[model samples]
Target chain A: MNHPPTTATLLALLATLACNVDRKQDDVPATDPPTPHVALLTSGPVSDAGWHAGAYEGLQLIGDSLGFEVSHQQTRTPAEFDEAFISYAEDGYGLIFGHGFEYQDAASRAGEQYPDVTFVVSGGSRPSANVVPLLFHLNEASYLAGMAAGAVTAAGIVGMVGGVEIPTAKGTFVAFEAGVKAVRADAAVLETFTGDWYDPSAAKEAAAAQLRQGADVLIHNLDAASFGFFQAVREAREGGSEAWAFGMNRDQNDVAPDVIVGSAVINIPAMFLRTATAWRDGTLGGVAEYAGLRVGAVEFVPNPAQEGVIPPEALARIDEARQAIIAGELEVPRIEYLEPEDDDPPSP
Target chain B: MNRTLTPVLTATAALAATLAVAAALLALGGHSPGAVFAALLRGAFGTWDRFFSFTLVRATPLLLTGLAVALAFKARVWNIGAEGQLHAGALAGVAVAILLPVHSPLLVLPATLAAAAAAGALWAAVPAAMKTRMGVGEVITTLLMNFVAVFLAQFLVQGPLQEPRGVFNQTDEIPLAARLPALLPDTRLHLGFLLGIVIAVALWLYLTRTPGGFRLRAVGASPRAAEVSGRFRAGPVVWLAFLTSGAIAGLAGWIQVAGVTHRMYEGLSPGWGYTAIAVALLARLNPLAVVVTAIVFGALSAGGGAMQREAGVPEVWVRGIEALVILAVLTVDRSWQVLAGGGSRD
Candidate 1:
């Protein structure tokens, strides 16, 4: 009896077809003599001016400081993640930064294939021998920002707008909520997750919803969506309302100098350079790199334009909390979203 | 021989033209064209492991979606909502995977797939009913439904179907029982690829051998002529095409989730549904041909990543090259027809 070709046979034929083509070996050496090549893969465009921009700057900083050949690509989907990792590793890129938690799975897979290449994922949930999660503990700074929001809210109401309630984002809000309550015990807090990372309209609508509920101070953990939050707050103040916003992730105070009180920032460039240095020195990887206020990586930077807007006591208390957090006297709230394999559902 | 060779010749012309144009662009952008091309080829098929794991694994969904689009276009039904139908199926399949009481792989897998297909068909039925009853166009209806489906998926991941912790907007992974087994011993390629091939072969046989398929094609070629000459009803045939296309697309969604992703998340597709149109059209709406065309697209996508990684080419440029190739394909195919016409006249 004649049988049709099975998938196994067909796949074999496809590979054979590919194999038949004459191939040229890569003549370019994997790494140049003096410096190793580095790359960054972002899920969003670098022009996003938030998450992706910060990473792009880090890539540039690494290149400028280390004299390495640096490049950046805005990858859209998970399928591209493996390809980017494998390609970079094959080309002798010593370090590749996938600037989001989403890169963890693909990074680990590629890390296994190329043992020498170091893959660093920002806000990543997992860590491997070669794949290291560069955890930016911004929640500690958000806690301080929450204290500032609590101190300055004229209406005694504050709002927290977020993009996708991932554990990292949630941890910031959780710490912020705790910090707000600590400063103003009677302050009413409102929370909304826009369920997006880059939708400005949705973020604007969410901020507006919180403003309409009488939130005089707003803070957000959105990426490019942060623009909408600031816009909504600025419009609220222009419309004769007493509303202000704190910027989250990177120093976004200059983005909206008039309305932004302060920024809870993660100094991503410094972290990338430090990580790259460690890799160069053969002392990086195999564990999570927790960058927080202690390492001078995360901090709450006050807006220069609105210098005196925060009362002296609030600023002093914020400084105190910062010291306490660094000294282990104050413990900020955090969420361990990363799971071990066994935590997943059991096999049938 | 002349008839069979025409498509091959046109395809070859399209590929060559695309490469020439792309090489110029790459050179203009300060990249070595030879290096980039070599990187692209190696990325797609450099190793047996890459071919099965990267190329074929990526091709699986494209093949299924291409077949769906080809089947519908064969009957002159424009189903832009394959994206929405796919999402509908994924949502339903995941819901069943999580909520169903059955534990056996045999029972659970089939039931989940059935639910996905039904959900996909139901999603398509909305546009089909609107087109048949109100005489509204299916193109706009189907396209609009995609947005609704995406929003619905977003809501499900965030709200009711969310993972227990509720930290992120994604569903929990389905049980091991529901997952499609790996086709290769140590590769990521799964049973879904085989399923896609089987479906393509079956569809080709149905389109060529079945009476219903003939009636559908007749309606597509000319509805009025079909009704007068062949005594075929266009309405039923169109509805059949719409629903069947939706069913196939829905299965694609489920297979992707069950075979690869193992969970439902936003942006799981990365616009595979929209890409299927080009895949189908490039194959001239032939199901068997879609299999080949889909693999070509799959290789392009897989290679695009490698180009970015190996040649330091930006992803946007790789995407630009891909679009250029598709454009070249359509143009060359059209020009080949004119050339053939000139040859016939001579």
Candidate 2:
């Protein structure tokens, strides 16, 4: 009968004891200031071996090359976003990267509060004095990969499997369709979005449906679901149909080497390194940082083992287009999500 | 005298044993257990700011939902649809807050929260009716309703309730008038925490002091006995538990949006409805104890993030440790009941 009250008291007492222990530990002051700390916050686990993993790699690259202390926290909820940002900033982290577009609002709020800390968000739309959006023009690389798909497809049909119909994902498909038409004016392109980023079964089902409709070359912008897309294409090949797949996000060319013609790669580690170095030199501007074919951050990397998979003529054309994009001669189509800024508005 | 002391000692031993196992596991993973535990404590209770801003804010939702679960379980209603009820409430709350034209705080806040509670009650009403009228098992129906609620939320956010920009898969922020007022200045803690505490005390009083509460508890203890001895049908009590539980859970969802996020988005709950089951069980279905248990869980959640940041432990491992703690506590509670010569309370 009295157990519940006693148990509650005991639990409360234990919590208090733990708090006192933490306070005692905090009493000891730091003898020396630690090195400049850089932190990364991701919404998903880094073990996904794709988008999140790439960001984690970039964090490690900054730590290894720039000699900065590094930390990473996989935040699960939006409520944790502000907490993580404040915690890192309070601990003297000079630069903190919120690794997805969802971090944009939180980063904007945190940036205003912690003016000294530089907050970078990938695929972010909002940009403030300290909140820089790391926009990746992966559509440019997707266009090149589309050109390769158009060349490699003997069936005169290509497919694009994507996760989510967001502007960014749709932009890649738009550029990819244009790329295919650029190479083959009459080529039929198929596109499907599974509405989920990590459902391999849905991606595979979409891939299979595309393959059934005579798409021999396929490209996918999915995370863990890309495995299902690749599996579908491999199954098509295994069934004695000529099939090939292109990888998206990071250098996934090695993932399905036997069937992969190339991969539209994002050099995330290099971008993180450059961003960190810029932050150190005080050259990281408030404007959204654009990294694309021009900056060598985005590329269409053809598989080394499948050197001759793409027609030789198509390879030359891809190289030409790459150079044109880098030289600002050819424009790859994209959806602009960032609003135009009027002036350097002062902070409220 | 010895019996009262034995249960306390057993609970303490179980907790110590769980910590030892957790420490050993951390050491095996090449992390200093002391540093990790210290980091967790500092993250959760390191300062008043951290506790109020992070831990309490995180606990608000869990506290409400835990109370909801406890209330339902107390009446032996077996209502497992709190998750769906939460989603339904959130969607309804957001709809009212955004669409309602009255900009006054008095009109909008209460109306929005009332709509949320009604929507939640309506959601649970489906399963409650099924169980009462059709003699269907509520376990399956309630659980399945969760999926329906989630999908409905997704559709609404993507379609009807999508922001005017139509770029992100979320609703526009609720107006300032509809937002929960801040309870603590300069902290994210909002009126929701106080609301939860108030609801807990009210629920505790209702469950212990009211005649209706006695009838509900009697039916929960033994429906046949209640029918014969208490002379009351259990059906009405079950319905009451279902609607009340759903209403509280619904409040948890909308309060989270009003107080913390200020915007409705997909994945807002982070499985808090499901975790409420653990919270309710850990509290032994006591309304007041649920408040304490919810904070403990909130600390674990807040500290789990720190374990990743400061301790360098991965999230998967932190979750494993959380599961271990829950298991240990339940096991100890079960053993205490057995030692007390109480054969199956359920």
Candidate 3:
């Protein structure tokens, strides 16, 4: 009855509002070639204070140190990947960092469209002429941290609590187990995956289960869930049991300094800065850029408060192993996920 | 005439009030409100290219799901399982498109879409059967089904449906022949938008013209009244609404993958089904108006990104503004109804 007129009015009102709100086109002033602009896109919020936060810090570092105009967008869905990439490229962003493996496909498509703009994806697989994968070899550091865990464990049992059993997370645990065996051949090792990267309760429960099974030292490869993992170890100490934990992904030594023996950290901000600097100098190749102990982008940082938690001999062995890994003499166990480079085949 | 004029004036007042509040919030957050709004408008509709590529592309899923929700709500059927149905549709579509071994574009596309629709209908059948046969409430069943569907999708993608390489937690890209054809050249807008528009028009016609539509509406108004006066069983009409709504929603899922992503992933939907409730409500359960309301929400989404990019507003702020606008609109609509002596419908 009256609904027809009401609907008509609604449409007319929307039309008028849209027409009135047309953005003024006179804002842009003709300017000669502007400074190179850089942008970052993350599927999750940067306020997570771990993986995404590290990337955000890296973007800021590039802006502060390299003097490039930097911007960041927290994209919600896969659909937004292409939209964000195109929008930034259209707005004259010279370099854009899509900070996840999920971005590789979208980055590849956007790369083909905007060949002039370089798109970098952290933990990405595929790489094209304009798409670069920034691979973080944090397993190298995790191995050293595992050596420390092996030495510090009073029960001769160490555990690894990981978030998601993806190749990247699994690689860290594999290398850690290897490092533990290298230190204590008879040591018992345990591993558990929470199947999530952000569920704190799940991570805590996993860590608690490992501790209850006589594991004195634990290392975790989780993001936001690391807090819960550390809480389990801290709670063990409160229960009058000797427990120590290791942090992963970023330098989290201060997060739970008392219970944490050390941390396997990927210097994400530094790696981002180096990549942006290379892009600016036109030296950034389409090939995947591996950041590891050799490049000083990954390291095992000992907690200052937990001094001498790792025995002297064990610390020395960790240092030796770190050197060997950097020299390519020691190969830390890692899951090879990246597609083989097409341009340069591996020598048989 | 007075009835229509009052509601329209109330809606206009609501729009002005919401904008004023949004401006104040933006200014409080240390952003220039005019600049932020300008950036949002520019990002959503400044260019023909953006309108087609971003706005319409985003609207395609919303439009389909909105129609599904509108139709169900019109019949007073609480089909809260569109999210699950959409996922079931996507999973079925992808499974058929990838494994069917049919390379012909015509055959593969149609078969894939039909499978999706069937899967969605099947998913809704569970809740429908629970409600009709067991006399169970659909609200809880449909809502719970969403979690089950999401976890099932995650399991399939991580296990059986994983890419050949088994590195990423997603399915392999569907064949090129299965991908939706672009509706507009040089834009991300696909045939899905056209499909959605056609569906909306068809649904509008059905609701306004058909005898079956009248029965459904009569039952929706009051099942007892329909049974007494129209002498038609409300049960069959309710079943029809649920199945049809589920089928449309299922199309939305496959259309998204067939059109845009080209593959099924864990987070296939960003809660488009949940958002569809708001879309349907804002359109007053009218199928045709859902087309416009869906686009309005699409613009908000497209512009939300720009607000972050151009105005330096955080995603939280943008989301908050969106919620505020929706609340304002609904409040005004309700207040007008009450003032006109109609009271609340629900």
Candidate 4:
């Protein structure tokens, strides 16, 4: 913006350098804006307004506070993953957050290729020499959400709907079921995989199926599908039945204001800043590290506006479970599928 | 000179005007339109490899779908179900690849390809039959069938065809034996590109030289006049045209799956069917011309991401440029039609 007239002026300079004789028409290098050189490549756009939004918000926060240049490239396929990384690296970007688990393989190759730059993948497994997997131990929060869901279910029947069955995604569900069992011995917990990250319709169908089977409380481990789960409970309550819903990934009680009881909140921006600062300090890579309950990175946020919906005894149990997990007494279930560990032994 | 320059100049002016409007919109929104354009060009053609890679990758499906639309349009038959037909082809190709026990690429490749083409032909035949026998609109029937094709792919991926271990809504990767060999070492361009070229050349010869193709063109020009001549049956020619067009588009989808993604996911197409309509029309339904047009569009899409990455433009704005290009072409077509119609009327 400060250099619009300088574009035409640069054309004049290029002409002057060519020699004073025949005035020639050069292909005008006059088409684009002068932008600083920092870029990030992601597998999907944040326009999705849900799972990807919190990550985008963290990126924006970095832009505002850190005074660093920022740009995002949305890729559609796994094939483009490496290409996007190479593109950002070749363009001389300082830091890049790959924003998804799919970027692990590409980030490894990129880390080796562009050793000068730092690369981060949101839920990646093995951090190469230059790449770091900023693993958010949301299962700590998920365990708390399960306590809430378990406490509210009078029928002893609660349901969990998950969006892709990846290990990181599955960890939340595994921990949630564990938390439910700890609270109540004879509870019936049904889990379903809608098999999509953004299918609201499928999520709604899974919610309805759970509801029909007499599930009064529901928790969703979905990205965009949480809307459908919340809608199912809201619709149920409208039809004169008492129903409660819980959220995942980010604090999503705001999504369905009246219907949501609480959300398992993960402070992505805190993790992002910590990871970036660690990378700057030369202490970021090697081994898959995690930020759990200790760093206040992951926690459950109950809707303060609606306190009576979740029984006080249940909240107390949730608090107890949270304390137990933080104190290292409860080993939250997680899918260990990724490595620099040569063997990918089958999970039970 | 008059004929060539007239159309070219008309196209260029129309494109420039639409791009100007698009730029103004971007600028008014407080974004750098110039940066977006530069990033697009740099992303698409910044280097020799990038240009060729974008052109080749984008051209693969466009080549097949362009041929499909051109073939049917030549016979004056509207087969608007290439999208659906393509999915049907992918469904068969994926099924055959996953089910077949054969190890060698030589055997599995041809079998899967044949299955895909046959499935596409079968999908197209339903609408072709309706149009020929029941006097139904092929456009509506083909359009309606796309949902069935899309949802059928979804259902199979989620239910019976699902990879039992993974709970994601995606199919198992096709066997390595069914995959196409890459055309280039670094780029994703595959054997389908060469095949697309060969098919385009064959179509060009058939449309211009062969008696059957001439009759189809005659029908397209004036179906009533072709009937009055009493030399050929428009019904069978139209039916065959529709089915074959669908089969080619289906082949396109199958190749995209095996050659590129290696797995099937929903939204496999970012509206490749509709993109084929533009590809066919821009070349004036000429098979040879379609090659160039498809590459241009491929550049636009392939370059769009670069705009987002390097230039800081949003995906929506990158898509706006594509819409502008299409609108420019359409406006040119409409003006040409109006001018020609007006002159003939006079």
Model 3 lDDT tens row, A157-236 = 99999887788888899999988888888999999988888999999999999999999999999989999999999999
lDDT of 1 by residue, A1-348 (tens): 111233235345435433443344434553454678889999887777777888888889989998888877678767667667766776678899999888877787677778888999998866777888998889999999999988999889999999987888999998999889889999999999887888999999999999999899999999988888899999999999988999999799899999999999988888988888888888998888989999988999999999888999999999999999999899999888765533442221
- The candidate maximizing DockQ is 2
DockQ of predicted model 3: 0.34
DockQ, all candidates in order:
0.24, 0.38, 0.34, 0.25
Residue A228, candidate 2: Cα error in Å is 1.2
Candidate 1 collision pairs = none
RMSD of each: 5.6, 3.1, 3.7, 6.5
Clashing pairs in 3: none
Candidate 1 colliding pairs, count = 0
lDDT tens per residue, model 4, B206-234 = 98899988988888887888988999878
Query: Could you tell me the TM-score of candidate 3?
Result: 0.94
lDDT of 2 by residue, A1-348 (tens): 434454565566567657666766675455333688999999998998988999999999999998998999999888999899988887778899999888977888788789989999999888878999999899999999999988888999999999987777888889989999999999999999898999999999999999999999999999989999999999999999999999999788788899899999888889989999999999895899998988888999999989998989999999999999999999999988785543533211
The DockQ-based CAPRI class assigned to model 1 is: acceptable
* Candidate 3 segments exceeding 4 Å error: A1-25, A29-33, A340-348, B1-15, B343-346
Model 4 chain A: weakest 10-residue lDDT segment is A17-26
lDDT of 2 at B216: 82
Candidate 4 i-RMS: 12.9
| Interface root-mean-square deviation (Å) of every model | 9.5, 4.9, 7.3, 12.9
